[model samples]
Target: MQPSHTPHVLVVMGVAGTGKTTIGPLLAARLGVPYAEGDDFHPQANIAKMSAGTPLTDDDRAPWLDAIGRWAHDRAGLGGVVSCSALKRGYRDRLRAAAPGVAFVHLTGDRELIEDRMAHRKGHFMPTALLDSQFATLQPLAADEAGVEVDVSGDPTEITERAVAALAHLAPPQ
Candidate 1:
Protein backbone atom coordinates (compact mmCIF):
# COMPACT_ATOMS: atom_id res chain seq x y z
CA MET A 1 0.00 0.00 0.00
CA GLN A 2 1.19 3.52 -0.76
CA PRO A 3 1.76 5.55 2.39
CA SER A 4 0.04 8.82 3.25
CA HIS A 5 0.79 11.61 5.75
CA THR A 6 -2.53 12.05 7.49
CA PRO A 7 -2.36 11.09 11.16
CA HIS A 8 -5.00 8.81 12.69
CA VAL A 9 -5.87 6.71 15.75
CA LEU A 10 -5.94 2.91 15.75
CA VAL A 11 -7.89 0.91 18.28
CA VAL A 12 -6.42 -2.54 18.83
CA MET A 13 -9.38 -4.73 19.64
CA GLY A 14 -10.46 -8.27 20.42
CA VAL A 15 -11.80 -10.57 23.08
CA ALA A 16 -9.85 -10.68 26.32
CA GLY A 17 -6.45 -12.42 26.16
CA THR A 18 -6.17 -11.91 22.41
CA GLY A 19 -3.04 -9.81 23.05
CA LYS A 20 -4.53 -6.38 22.35
CA THR A 21 -2.76 -4.93 25.37
CA THR A 22 0.59 -6.45 24.48
CA ILE A 23 0.44 -5.49 20.80
CA GLY A 24 -0.97 -1.96 21.07
CA PRO A 25 2.13 -0.30 22.51
CA LEU A 26 4.44 -2.22 20.24
CA LEU A 27 2.43 -1.04 17.27
CA ALA A 28 2.37 2.55 18.58
CA ALA A 29 6.15 2.53 19.03
CA ARG A 30 6.63 1.06 15.58
CA LEU A 31 4.41 3.74 14.11
CA GLY A 32 6.05 6.49 16.24
CA VAL A 33 2.78 7.27 18.06
CA PRO A 34 1.60 7.25 21.66
CA TYR A 35 -0.36 4.42 23.25
CA ALA A 36 -3.36 4.35 25.57
CA GLU A 37 -4.52 1.51 27.74
CA GLY A 38 -8.23 0.93 27.20
CA ASP A 39 -8.66 -0.60 30.62
CA ASP A 40 -7.61 2.63 32.21
CA PHE A 41 -10.80 4.20 30.92
CA HIS A 42 -12.99 1.86 32.90
CA PRO A 43 -14.68 3.22 36.01
CA GLN A 44 -14.04 1.62 39.37
CA ALA A 45 -17.42 -0.11 39.37
CA ASN A 46 -16.75 -1.75 36.08
CA ILE A 47 -13.41 -3.01 37.31
CA ALA A 48 -15.01 -4.25 40.49
CA LYS A 49 -17.72 -6.09 38.57
CA MET A 50 -15.20 -7.71 36.24
CA SER A 51 -12.95 -8.57 39.14
CA ALA A 52 -15.90 -10.37 40.71
CA GLY A 53 -16.17 -12.48 37.53
CA THR A 54 -19.34 -10.74 36.34
CA PRO A 55 -19.57 -9.88 32.71
CA LEU A 56 -20.42 -6.23 32.20
CA THR A 57 -23.77 -5.20 30.85
CA ASP A 58 -24.01 -2.66 28.03
CA ASP A 59 -25.01 0.05 30.49
CA ASP A 60 -21.97 -0.69 32.61
CA ARG A 61 -19.74 -0.30 29.58
CA ALA A 62 -21.31 2.91 28.29
CA PRO A 63 -19.16 5.32 30.28
CA TRP A 64 -16.03 3.31 29.66
CA LEU A 65 -16.63 3.32 25.92
CA ASP A 66 -17.41 7.04 26.02
CA ALA A 67 -14.18 7.73 27.86
CA ILE A 68 -12.16 5.75 25.35
CA GLY A 69 -14.07 7.43 22.53
CA ARG A 70 -13.20 10.83 23.95
CA TRP A 71 -9.56 9.86 24.14
CA ALA A 72 -9.62 8.67 20.54
CA HIS A 73 -11.42 11.81 19.48
CA ASP A 74 -8.81 13.93 21.20
CA ARG A 75 -5.97 11.98 19.56
CA ALA A 76 -7.36 12.48 16.09
CA GLY A 77 -4.72 13.75 13.67
CA LEU A 78 -2.10 13.35 16.41
CA GLY A 79 -1.96 9.54 15.93
CA GLY A 80 -2.15 6.95 18.69
CA VAL A 81 -2.88 3.29 19.39
CA VAL A 82 -5.10 2.03 22.19
CA SER A 83 -5.94 -1.45 23.42
CA CYS A 84 -9.58 -2.37 24.02
CA SER A 85 -11.84 -5.40 24.14
CA ALA A 86 -14.20 -3.89 21.63
CA LEU A 87 -16.02 -7.17 21.32
CA LYS A 88 -19.20 -5.78 19.86
CA ARG A 89 -19.85 -3.90 16.66
CA GLY A 90 -21.92 -1.33 18.56
CA TYR A 91 -19.00 -0.50 20.82
CA ARG A 92 -16.73 0.01 17.83
CA ASP A 93 -19.40 2.06 16.10
CA ARG A 94 -19.62 4.29 19.14
CA LEU A 95 -15.89 4.84 19.01
CA ARG A 96 -15.89 5.52 15.28
CA ALA A 97 -18.72 7.97 15.66
CA ALA A 98 -16.68 9.87 18.23
CA ALA A 99 -13.53 9.74 16.11
CA PRO A 100 -14.47 9.52 12.48
CA GLY A 101 -10.97 8.68 11.28
CA VAL A 102 -10.38 5.97 13.82
CA ALA A 103 -9.30 2.63 12.37
CA PHE A 104 -9.00 -0.68 14.17
CA VAL A 105 -6.67 -3.64 14.53
CA HIS A 106 -8.56 -6.72 15.60
CA LEU A 107 -6.33 -9.30 17.24
CA THR A 108 -7.70 -12.83 16.85
CA GLY A 109 -6.67 -16.29 18.11
CA ASP A 110 -8.00 -19.68 19.00
CA ARG A 111 -10.17 -19.80 22.10
CA GLU A 112 -7.94 -22.40 23.71
CA LEU A 113 -4.92 -20.22 23.19
CA ILE A 114 -6.68 -17.17 24.58
CA GLU A 115 -7.94 -19.05 27.61
CA ASP A 116 -4.49 -20.45 28.28
CA ARG A 117 -3.05 -16.97 28.12
CA MET A 118 -5.72 -15.59 30.42
CA ALA A 119 -5.05 -18.33 32.94
CA HIS A 120 -1.39 -17.39 33.01
CA ARG A 121 -1.83 -13.63 33.25
CA LYS A 122 -0.92 -12.00 36.58
CA GLY A 123 -2.35 -9.00 38.45
CA HIS A 124 -5.00 -8.50 35.78
CA PHE A 125 -8.50 -7.83 37.06
CA MET A 126 -10.13 -9.94 34.37
CA PRO A 127 -10.50 -13.58 35.26
CA THR A 128 -10.63 -16.62 32.97
CA ALA A 129 -14.25 -17.19 33.88
CA LEU A 130 -15.22 -14.14 31.83
CA LEU A 131 -13.62 -15.55 28.69
CA ASP A 132 -16.76 -17.31 27.53
CA SER A 133 -18.81 -14.17 27.97
CA GLN A 134 -16.33 -12.16 25.99
CA PHE A 135 -16.39 -14.71 23.21
CA ALA A 136 -20.15 -14.75 23.26
CA THR A 137 -20.20 -10.98 22.99
CA LEU A 138 -17.64 -10.74 20.19
CA GLN A 139 -18.79 -9.62 16.81
CA PRO A 140 -15.84 -9.68 14.46
CA LEU A 141 -15.11 -6.59 12.43
CA ALA A 142 -17.61 -6.47 9.63
CA ALA A 143 -16.93 -5.90 5.92
CA ASP A 144 -17.74 -2.19 6.32
CA GLU A 145 -15.50 -1.58 9.30
CA ALA A 146 -12.14 0.10 8.75
CA GLY A 147 -9.83 -2.46 10.29
CA VAL A 148 -7.53 -5.45 9.86
CA GLU A 149 -7.42 -8.68 11.80
CA VAL A 150 -4.08 -10.05 12.92
CA ASP A 151 -3.69 -13.56 14.26
CA VAL A 152 -2.23 -13.65 17.74
CA SER A 153 -0.65 -17.07 17.40
CA GLY A 154 2.98 -16.05 17.85
CA ASP A 155 5.06 -13.99 20.27
CA PRO A 156 4.19 -10.35 20.96
CA THR A 157 6.90 -9.05 18.66
CA GLU A 158 5.81 -11.30 15.85
CA ILE A 159 2.20 -10.31 16.34
CA THR A 160 3.22 -6.66 16.43
CA GLU A 161 5.13 -7.04 13.19
CA ARG A 162 2.11 -8.60 11.56
CA ALA A 163 -0.07 -5.75 12.88
CA VAL A 164 2.33 -3.07 11.65
CA ALA A 165 2.37 -4.66 8.23
CA ALA A 166 -1.39 -5.17 8.17
CA LEU A 167 -2.04 -1.63 9.29
CA ALA A 168 0.59 0.08 7.17
CA HIS A 169 -2.06 1.43 4.85
CA LEU A 170 -3.57 3.36 7.75
CA ALA A 171 -0.33 4.79 9.11
CA PRO A 172 1.01 8.18 8.17
CA PRO A 173 3.76 8.14 5.56
CA GLN A 174 7.36 8.50 6.69
Candidate 2:
Protein backbone atom coordinates (compact mmCIF):
# COMPACT_ATOMS: atom_id res chain seq x y z
CA MET A 1 0.00 0.00 0.00
CA GLN A 2 1.63 3.23 -1.09
CA PRO A 3 1.37 6.23 1.22
CA SER A 4 -0.73 9.20 0.22
CA HIS A 5 0.72 12.46 -1.07
CA THR A 6 -0.02 14.10 2.28
CA PRO A 7 3.22 12.52 3.56
CA HIS A 8 2.53 10.62 6.76
CA VAL A 9 5.50 10.00 9.02
CA LEU A 10 4.67 7.57 11.79
CA VAL A 11 6.34 8.63 15.00
CA VAL A 12 5.65 5.67 17.30
CA MET A 13 6.16 7.86 20.32
CA GLY A 14 5.37 7.39 23.98
CA VAL A 15 6.84 6.84 27.43
CA ALA A 16 8.92 3.72 28.02
CA GLY A 17 7.06 0.39 27.70
CA THR A 18 4.50 1.75 25.29
CA GLY A 19 5.47 -0.98 22.76
CA LYS A 20 6.92 1.39 20.17
CA THR A 21 9.49 -1.21 19.25
CA THR A 22 6.98 -3.99 18.82
CA ILE A 23 4.27 -2.02 17.11
CA GLY A 24 6.44 0.09 14.80
CA PRO A 25 7.45 -2.73 12.50
CA LEU A 26 3.92 -4.06 12.25
CA LEU A 27 2.61 -0.63 11.35
CA ALA A 28 5.36 -0.22 8.80
CA ALA A 29 4.64 -3.62 7.30
CA ARG A 30 0.96 -2.82 7.05
CA LEU A 31 1.81 0.47 5.40
CA GLY A 32 4.45 -1.20 3.21
CA VAL A 33 7.18 1.17 4.42
CA PRO A 34 10.50 0.62 6.15
CA TYR A 35 10.58 0.99 9.92
CA ALA A 36 13.17 2.83 11.98
CA GLU A 37 13.49 2.13 15.67
CA GLY A 38 14.40 5.32 17.51
CA ASP A 39 16.33 3.48 20.17
CA ASP A 40 18.81 2.35 17.54
CA PHE A 41 20.11 5.90 17.28
CA HIS A 42 20.77 6.39 21.02
CA PRO A 43 24.36 7.27 21.88
CA GLN A 44 26.30 4.79 23.99
CA ALA A 45 26.49 7.18 26.91
CA ASN A 46 22.76 7.76 26.87
CA ILE A 47 22.24 4.01 26.81
CA ALA A 48 24.59 3.63 29.79
CA LYS A 49 22.70 6.22 31.81
CA MET A 50 19.34 4.64 31.12
CA SER A 51 20.78 1.21 31.83
CA ALA A 52 22.03 2.54 35.15
CA GLY A 53 18.48 3.61 35.95
CA THR A 54 19.16 7.29 35.45
CA PRO A 55 16.71 9.43 33.54
CA LEU A 56 18.24 11.23 30.58
CA THR A 57 18.34 15.00 30.52
CA ASP A 58 17.13 16.93 27.51
CA ASP A 59 20.76 17.67 26.73
CA ASP A 60 21.45 13.95 26.65
CA ARG A 61 18.60 13.51 24.19
CA ALA A 62 19.07 16.48 21.85
CA PRO A 63 21.68 14.88 19.65
CA TRP A 64 19.71 11.63 19.54
CA LEU A 65 16.51 13.47 18.62
CA ASP A 66 18.37 15.35 15.91
CA ALA A 67 19.59 12.07 14.46
CA ILE A 68 16.09 10.61 14.47
CA GLY A 69 14.74 13.76 12.88
CA ARG A 70 17.32 13.59 10.14
CA TRP A 71 16.62 9.92 9.61
CA ALA A 72 12.90 10.64 9.36
CA HIS A 73 13.53 13.40 6.84
CA ASP A 74 15.71 11.13 4.75
CA ARG A 75 13.38 8.16 4.86
CA ALA A 76 10.25 10.20 4.29
CA GLY A 77 11.51 10.75 0.77
CA LEU A 78 10.51 7.14 0.15
CA GLY A 79 8.18 7.05 3.18
CA GLY A 80 8.78 5.00 6.35
CA VAL A 81 7.98 4.48 10.03
CA VAL A 82 10.10 5.67 12.98
CA SER A 83 9.77 4.90 16.66
CA CYS A 84 10.76 7.53 19.23
CA SER A 85 9.80 8.74 22.66
CA ALA A 86 9.49 12.28 21.34
CA LEU A 87 8.39 13.18 24.85
CA LYS A 88 8.31 16.92 24.45
CA ARG A 89 6.82 19.47 22.12
CA GLY A 90 10.28 20.87 21.48
CA TYR A 91 11.51 17.48 20.40
CA ARG A 92 8.52 17.01 18.09
CA ASP A 93 9.15 20.50 16.71
CA ARG A 94 12.73 19.60 15.97
CA LEU A 95 11.51 16.49 14.16
CA ARG A 96 8.99 18.57 12.23
CA ALA A 97 11.71 21.03 11.32
CA ALA A 98 13.70 18.22 9.79
CA ALA A 99 10.71 16.85 7.86
CA PRO A 100 8.11 19.53 7.35
CA GLY A 101 5.21 17.17 6.65
CA VAL A 102 6.01 14.49 9.23
CA ALA A 103 3.17 13.12 11.34
CA PHE A 104 3.19 11.39 14.73
CA VAL A 105 1.48 8.30 16.21
CA HIS A 106 1.34 8.75 19.96
CA LEU A 107 0.77 5.59 22.00
CA THR A 108 -0.54 5.92 25.51
CA GLY A 109 -1.70 3.53 28.24
CA ASP A 110 -2.08 3.18 32.00
CA ARG A 111 1.05 3.98 33.97
CA GLU A 112 0.84 0.78 35.98
CA LEU A 113 0.54 -1.31 32.85
CA ILE A 114 3.51 0.42 31.30
CA GLU A 115 5.57 0.00 34.44
CA ASP A 116 4.74 -3.69 34.55
CA ARG A 117 5.87 -4.14 30.98
CA MET A 118 9.09 -2.24 31.63
CA ALA A 119 9.88 -4.41 34.63
CA HIS A 120 9.49 -7.65 32.74
CA ARG A 121 11.23 -6.51 29.60
CA LYS A 122 14.89 -7.47 29.20
CA GLY A 123 17.85 -6.29 27.10
CA HIS A 124 16.50 -2.77 27.07
CA PHE A 125 18.37 0.21 28.48
CA MET A 126 15.41 1.99 29.98
CA PRO A 127 14.44 0.93 33.52
CA THR A 128 11.04 0.71 35.16
CA ALA A 129 11.93 3.35 37.73
CA LEU A 130 12.44 5.91 34.99
CA LEU A 131 8.79 5.62 34.00
CA ASP A 132 7.94 8.50 36.28
CA SER A 133 10.51 10.76 34.67
CA GLN A 134 9.29 9.74 31.23
CA PHE A 135 5.72 10.62 32.10
CA ALA A 136 6.90 13.80 33.77
CA THR A 137 8.77 14.83 30.66
CA LEU A 138 6.04 13.76 28.24
CA GLN A 139 4.02 16.55 26.66
CA PRO A 140 1.24 14.90 24.71
CA LEU A 141 0.83 16.01 21.12
CA ALA A 142 -1.81 18.64 20.71
CA ALA A 143 -5.08 17.69 19.00
CA ASP A 144 -4.15 19.88 16.06
CA GLU A 145 -0.73 18.34 15.81
CA ALA A 146 -0.09 16.29 12.68
CA GLY A 147 -0.78 12.92 14.28
CA VAL A 148 -3.11 10.39 15.78
CA GLU A 149 -3.17 9.18 19.39
CA VAL A 150 -3.94 5.54 20.17
CA ASP A 151 -4.27 3.67 23.43
CA VAL A 152 -1.76 0.87 23.50
CA SER A 153 -3.23 -1.04 26.41
CA GLY A 154 -4.89 -3.60 24.17
CA ASP A 155 -3.31 -6.47 22.25
CA PRO A 156 -0.41 -5.53 19.99
CA THR A 157 -2.26 -6.56 16.85
CA GLU A 158 -5.26 -4.49 17.83
CA ILE A 159 -3.08 -1.47 18.52
CA THR A 160 -1.31 -1.84 15.20
CA GLU A 161 -4.52 -2.22 13.27
CA ARG A 162 -6.05 0.81 14.92
CA ALA A 163 -2.97 2.90 14.23
CA VAL A 164 -2.87 1.73 10.62
CA ALA A 165 -6.52 2.58 10.13
CA ALA A 166 -6.04 5.95 11.73
CA LEU A 167 -3.10 6.67 9.45
CA ALA A 168 -5.12 5.60 6.43
CA HIS A 169 -7.82 8.08 7.36
CA LEU A 170 -5.31 10.86 7.95
CA ALA A 171 -3.47 10.15 4.72
CA PRO A 172 -4.46 12.09 1.62
CA PRO A 173 -6.04 10.38 -1.37
CA GLN A 174 -3.59 8.55 -3.58
Candidate 3:
Protein backbone atom coordinates (compact mmCIF):
# COMPACT_ATOMS: atom_id res chain seq x y z
CA MET A 1 0.00 0.00 0.00
CA GLN A 2 1.07 3.58 -0.56
CA PRO A 3 2.34 5.52 2.41
CA SER A 4 -0.21 7.58 4.32
CA HIS A 5 -0.96 11.07 3.05
CA THR A 6 -3.70 13.55 2.27
CA PRO A 7 -5.96 12.61 -0.59
CA HIS A 8 -5.70 14.31 -4.01
CA VAL A 9 -8.26 14.98 -6.73
CA LEU A 10 -6.93 14.59 -10.27
CA VAL A 11 -8.37 14.39 -13.76
CA VAL A 12 -6.52 12.13 -16.15
CA MET A 13 -6.79 14.46 -19.13
CA GLY A 14 -5.98 13.62 -22.72
CA VAL A 15 -7.29 12.76 -26.17
CA ALA A 16 -8.96 9.46 -26.85
CA GLY A 17 -6.69 6.43 -26.80
CA THR A 18 -4.28 8.14 -24.43
CA GLY A 19 -5.21 5.53 -21.80
CA LYS A 20 -6.98 7.85 -19.38
CA THR A 21 -9.45 5.11 -18.55
CA THR A 22 -6.70 2.60 -17.98
CA ILE A 23 -4.42 4.75 -15.91
CA GLY A 24 -6.93 6.80 -13.92
CA PRO A 25 -8.18 3.80 -12.03
CA LEU A 26 -4.68 2.57 -11.38
CA LEU A 27 -3.71 5.90 -9.94
CA ALA A 28 -6.89 6.00 -7.87
CA ALA A 29 -6.25 2.48 -6.64
CA ARG A 30 -2.72 3.35 -5.65
CA LEU A 31 -3.88 6.47 -3.88
CA GLY A 32 -6.80 4.69 -2.25
CA VAL A 33 -9.34 7.06 -3.71
CA PRO A 34 -12.44 6.55 -5.81
CA TYR A 35 -12.29 6.68 -9.63
CA ALA A 36 -14.72 8.59 -11.81
CA GLU A 37 -15.03 7.76 -15.51
CA GLY A 38 -15.63 10.99 -17.35
CA ASP A 39 -17.25 9.37 -20.33
CA ASP A 40 -20.20 8.45 -18.19
CA PHE A 41 -21.08 12.10 -17.91
CA HIS A 42 -21.61 12.46 -21.68
CA PRO A 43 -25.10 12.78 -23.04
CA GLN A 44 -26.25 10.13 -25.48
CA ALA A 45 -26.24 12.64 -28.30
CA ASN A 46 -22.60 13.45 -27.74
CA ILE A 47 -21.73 9.78 -27.72
CA ALA A 48 -23.73 9.29 -30.89
CA LYS A 49 -21.94 12.19 -32.53
CA MET A 50 -18.49 10.85 -31.68
CA SER A 51 -19.45 7.28 -32.47
CA ALA A 52 -20.51 8.45 -35.94
CA GLY A 53 -17.15 10.21 -36.47
CA THR A 54 -18.34 13.73 -35.80
CA PRO A 55 -16.56 16.01 -33.39
CA LEU A 56 -18.57 17.53 -30.59
CA THR A 57 -19.10 21.25 -30.80
CA ASP A 58 -18.27 23.33 -27.75
CA ASP A 59 -21.99 23.90 -27.31
CA ASP A 60 -22.54 20.20 -27.25
CA ARG A 61 -19.90 19.73 -24.60
CA ALA A 62 -21.01 22.52 -22.29
CA PRO A 63 -23.37 20.50 -20.15
CA TRP A 64 -21.02 17.55 -20.20
CA LEU A 65 -18.12 19.63 -18.99
CA ASP A 66 -20.26 21.21 -16.35
CA ALA A 67 -21.28 17.83 -15.11
CA ILE A 68 -17.73 16.62 -14.83
CA GLY A 69 -16.73 19.90 -13.27
CA ARG A 70 -19.39 19.48 -10.63
CA TRP A 71 -18.23 15.96 -10.02
CA ALA A 72 -14.67 17.15 -9.64
CA HIS A 73 -15.80 19.83 -7.26
CA ASP A 74 -17.58 17.35 -5.07
CA ARG A 75 -14.89 14.68 -5.31
CA ALA A 76 -12.18 17.17 -4.39
CA GLY A 77 -13.63 17.50 -0.91
CA LEU A 78 -12.82 13.85 -0.34
CA GLY A 79 -10.01 13.51 -2.90
CA GLY A 80 -10.53 11.22 -5.91
CA VAL A 81 -9.42 10.55 -9.45
CA VAL A 82 -11.35 10.97 -12.70
CA SER A 83 -10.80 10.38 -16.40
CA CYS A 84 -11.65 13.27 -18.68
CA SER A 85 -10.78 14.25 -22.24
CA ALA A 86 -9.93 17.73 -21.08
CA LEU A 87 -8.50 18.49 -24.52
CA LYS A 88 -8.58 22.25 -24.33
CA ARG A 89 -7.29 24.75 -21.84
CA GLY A 90 -10.77 26.19 -21.57
CA TYR A 91 -12.17 22.86 -20.54
CA ARG A 92 -9.50 22.40 -17.93
CA ASP A 93 -10.06 25.95 -16.80
CA ARG A 94 -13.75 25.30 -16.28
CA LEU A 95 -12.86 22.29 -14.18
CA ARG A 96 -10.49 24.41 -12.13
CA ALA A 97 -13.22 26.94 -11.59
CA ALA A 98 -15.39 24.26 -10.12
CA ALA A 99 -12.68 22.74 -7.98
CA PRO A 100 -10.08 25.30 -7.10
CA GLY A 101 -7.11 23.08 -6.39
CA VAL A 102 -7.89 20.05 -8.54
CA ALA A 103 -4.82 18.72 -10.35
CA PHE A 104 -4.50 16.98 -13.71
CA VAL A 105 -2.40 14.30 -15.35
CA HIS A 106 -2.18 14.98 -19.07
CA LEU A 107 -1.42 11.79 -20.96
CA THR A 108 0.20 12.44 -24.34
CA GLY A 109 1.85 10.63 -27.26
CA ASP A 110 2.66 10.99 -30.97
CA ARG A 111 -0.08 10.61 -33.59
CA GLU A 112 1.26 7.31 -34.83
CA LEU A 113 1.31 5.82 -31.35
CA ILE A 114 -2.16 7.05 -30.45
CA GLU A 115 -3.67 6.04 -33.76
CA ASP A 116 -2.17 2.61 -33.43
CA ARG A 117 -3.75 2.23 -30.02
CA MET A 118 -7.10 3.54 -31.24
CA ALA A 119 -7.16 1.21 -34.22
CA HIS A 120 -6.96 -1.78 -31.94
CA ARG A 121 -9.26 -0.54 -29.20
CA LYS A 122 -12.58 -2.36 -28.95
CA GLY A 123 -16.05 -1.39 -27.72
CA HIS A 124 -15.24 2.32 -27.46
CA PHE A 125 -17.50 4.89 -29.05
CA MET A 126 -14.72 7.19 -30.24
CA PRO A 127 -13.63 6.25 -33.74
CA THR A 128 -10.00 6.42 -34.81
CA ALA A 129 -11.04 8.74 -37.63
CA LEU A 130 -11.83 11.48 -35.10
CA LEU A 131 -8.29 11.47 -33.75
CA ASP A 132 -7.36 14.29 -36.09
CA SER A 133 -10.19 16.46 -34.84
CA GLN A 134 -9.15 15.72 -31.29
CA PHE A 135 -5.60 16.71 -32.10
CA ALA A 136 -6.77 19.78 -33.92
CA THR A 137 -8.94 20.85 -31.01
CA LEU A 138 -6.28 20.14 -28.41
CA GLN A 139 -4.66 23.03 -26.64
CA PRO A 140 -1.66 21.68 -24.81
CA LEU A 141 -1.75 21.88 -21.03
CA ALA A 142 -0.35 25.28 -20.16
CA ALA A 143 2.83 25.69 -18.13
CA ASP A 144 0.85 27.40 -15.41
CA GLU A 145 -1.65 24.57 -15.09
CA ALA A 146 -1.55 22.54 -11.92
CA GLY A 147 -0.59 19.17 -13.34
CA VAL A 148 1.93 16.84 -14.98
CA GLU A 149 2.26 15.69 -18.59
CA VAL A 150 2.82 11.97 -18.93
CA ASP A 151 3.94 10.23 -22.10
CA VAL A 152 1.64 7.35 -23.03
CA SER A 153 4.25 5.31 -24.88
CA GLY A 154 4.94 3.13 -21.85
CA ASP A 155 2.86 0.41 -20.19
CA PRO A 156 0.00 1.41 -17.92
CA THR A 157 1.83 0.46 -14.75
CA GLU A 158 4.86 2.53 -15.66
CA ILE A 159 2.70 5.46 -16.69
CA THR A 160 0.63 5.34 -13.52
CA GLU A 161 3.77 5.06 -11.42
CA ARG A 162 5.11 8.14 -13.14
CA ALA A 163 1.89 10.00 -12.43
CA VAL A 164 1.98 9.02 -8.78
CA ALA A 165 5.60 10.06 -8.51
CA ALA A 166 4.98 13.34 -10.24
CA LEU A 167 2.17 14.05 -7.79
CA ALA A 168 4.25 13.21 -4.76
CA HIS A 169 4.04 16.77 -3.53
CA LEU A 170 0.27 16.36 -3.09
CA ALA A 171 0.69 13.87 -0.29
CA PRO A 172 -0.39 15.32 3.05
CA PRO A 173 2.29 15.64 5.68
CA GLN A 174 2.29 13.09 8.46
How do these models rank on TM-score, best leading? 1, 2, 3
Minimum summed lDDT over a 10-residue window in model 1 is located at 165-174
Cα lDDT, model 1, residue 31: 82
Supply the global lDDT for candidate 3.
0.87
TM-score of each: 0.95, 0.93, 0.93
Q: 1 or 2, which is superior by TM-score? A: 1
Model 1, range 1-174, lDDT digits (tens) per residue?
222666669899999999888899898888888899999999999999999999999999999999999999998878889988889999999998888889889999999999999999999999999999998899999988888999999899999989878877554412
lDDT of 3 by residue, 19-123 (tens): 999999999999888999999999999999998999999999999989988988887657889999989999998988888778888999999999999999899
Residue 154: error of model 1 in Å? Answer: 0.7
40-71: candidate 2 lDDT, tens digit per residue = 99999999999898888889999999999898
Ranking by lDDT: 1, 3, 2
Question: For model 1, which pairs clash?
Answer: 4-173
Global lDDT of each model? 0.88, 0.87, 0.87
> lDDT score, residue 106, model 1?
94
RMSD of each: 2.5, 1.9, 2.2
